[model samples]
Target: MYKKKYSNKFSVAPMLNYTDQYCRYFYRQLTKKTLLYTEMITSQELLYKNPDNYIRYTSNNQNPIAIQLAGNNINELTKCAMIAYSLGFNEINLNAGCPSKKAQLGGFGACLMLNPILLFNIIRAIYNTVPIPISIKIRLGTHNKNNYQHLYNFIKLVSKKNYCKRFIIHARIANLNGLNTKKNRCIPPLNYKYVYKIKKDFPNLKIILNGGIQNLQEAQKHLKIIDGVMLGRAIYKNPLMLCAVDQKIFSVHSIINKKILLDNMQKYIHYHSLKNIPIIYIFRHMLNIFYGKPQSKKLKQYFIHKIKNYTDITILFQKLSKKFNF
Candidate 1:
């Protein structure tokens, strides 16, 4: 369903605290083809957190969306995947890439790369229980260079056996040291050669390369070697890049005009305000959309701290439209 639904465009990474329904909806309004992903939800949290606040997704936000789960426990992960499938998600992705110490301490995330058997158990459980397809997002390995062989073995075991249909490689190794997530994203050099080798060895598996891929040119370059590409921080930082994705990567059948985006933002502002989620909570992402453009600073400043009311959001965007006129 995922491949057929969005076989042309690249995908937006599942950024934590950023790629929520609001961001997904806004991006979808800009382009029809780019596949958007949900923020990482830990298996334990999904089982224990109050669903009212933690697990939130609507069909209108992004229909072909994949829900990413962080966990190494087969039973818990499988249960979460089944729940996500029941909730109408088209695909369930295991988060084997996040390198946060907190995630590591929990015995999940990037730490799972060290134990392919454990990872395989989790993948197999999810694949067998849920009728929906399963995918994995992973880093090269944690702590050392030798882990790459095990990572490759893990991928081969899962992909060849059809435990999961796809694997999205982040193209870096987790340091598992004094580094923060931001540093983890950058400090670890991306190993594109290893990724190319993976594609070379596993010709039948669908490989999606991720990390440091910011624009269409870079994405097109990687697509020459991999089956797909996934965009991370860049998509959230500069959403207009998605417009280029439609034209350049997916070759979208039609273009979405700016008025439609603004209209949807207006509708969402009303909906979010009614939920009493302060307008700024939602508008914070829009600042990144206009970044690097004229008057962006002024608009960002206007709304950053003062979206107490819906009118504040309205006036702020109206002011930006008037000044920038994009």
Candidate 2:
């Protein structure tokens, strides 16, 4: 119920195009406790573009949520953090862990892992500007240089500012030169041992593990060793994965059945539909609701062939819900 509790439990990764406001709201509907995150918003986009667009929401999710930022400029980051804080974000997470060419060329992401002082400056400025918690999402190391000490020292330098209280570590090294964003995520092997060592060394630090975690059982296994687990593609592909998260991990039996969940989505779709926003933008996030269940393939076919407008989608959903008894 408290904001601080969110900082300690399971969270969804701040993925671009995957964890936008609509997606966050949908996930929040399934589980109220797991901390949701915004997609990586660059400081430049907020500074040069309309600051309101990136952080805008129809209604805030009931659970605590955080906004992750990608940039190297101290002042811009501070301003962006302040803007996000005003929008009611519970935490501001710095991106020192992404390995995309865009992130590297833009002077943020895993590339910043090598430049601890600059990352420190950016995080410190944001920390001083906002009252909310500051966190850093990072990889173990970058470019095959997996020196365990370097990882330790990186955290030491960034946390020296005393504002960063939480750290989410992706248990893999980022390949800056040879890999693209997709490859960087999959090609690298996961070294959970190093992540465990981090918790062992910084016993006081809140270290959340990311990378290669899919099902609740795996998440529970990691939770035994670290403070939390951050799910990436798995939750996006099968969002209903979070339906059991509250009961299995947090030990609170969630009463969120399919009827209530889809009704909420219907309301959200109608709200956007009134604004003339393309319904597909929101419906695409809901396509996986029937994942791993009976009548799933049939429902997917209906979406592909039958969906067009809000009315069509809603009608089809109602029919499918009745057919599946969901």
Best by lDDT: 2
| Candidate 1 global TM-score | 0.92
Deviating ranges (above 4 Å) for candidate 2: 1-5, 51-53, 294-298, 309-314, 323-326
lDDT of 1 by residue, 1-326 (tens): 23346552489899888887777777787777777788898988899887544457676556778888998778888789878877877788888888897887998888877776788888777878988777889888776743557767778776657777688999988888778888999999988888899889888788889988877889999998889999878888788887777778876566657777787787888887888887766677777766677777776676665564445666766765554434
Q: Model 2's lDDT to the true fold?
A: 0.83
Q: Clash pairs of candidate 1?
A: none
lDDT of 2 by residue, 154-175 (tens): 8888888477868999999998
The positional error of residue 104 in candidate 1, measured at the CA in angstroms, is 1.3
RMSD to native, candidate 1? 2.2
Worst 10 residues of 2 by lDDT: 1-10
TM-score of each candidate structure, all chains considered together = 0.92, 0.94
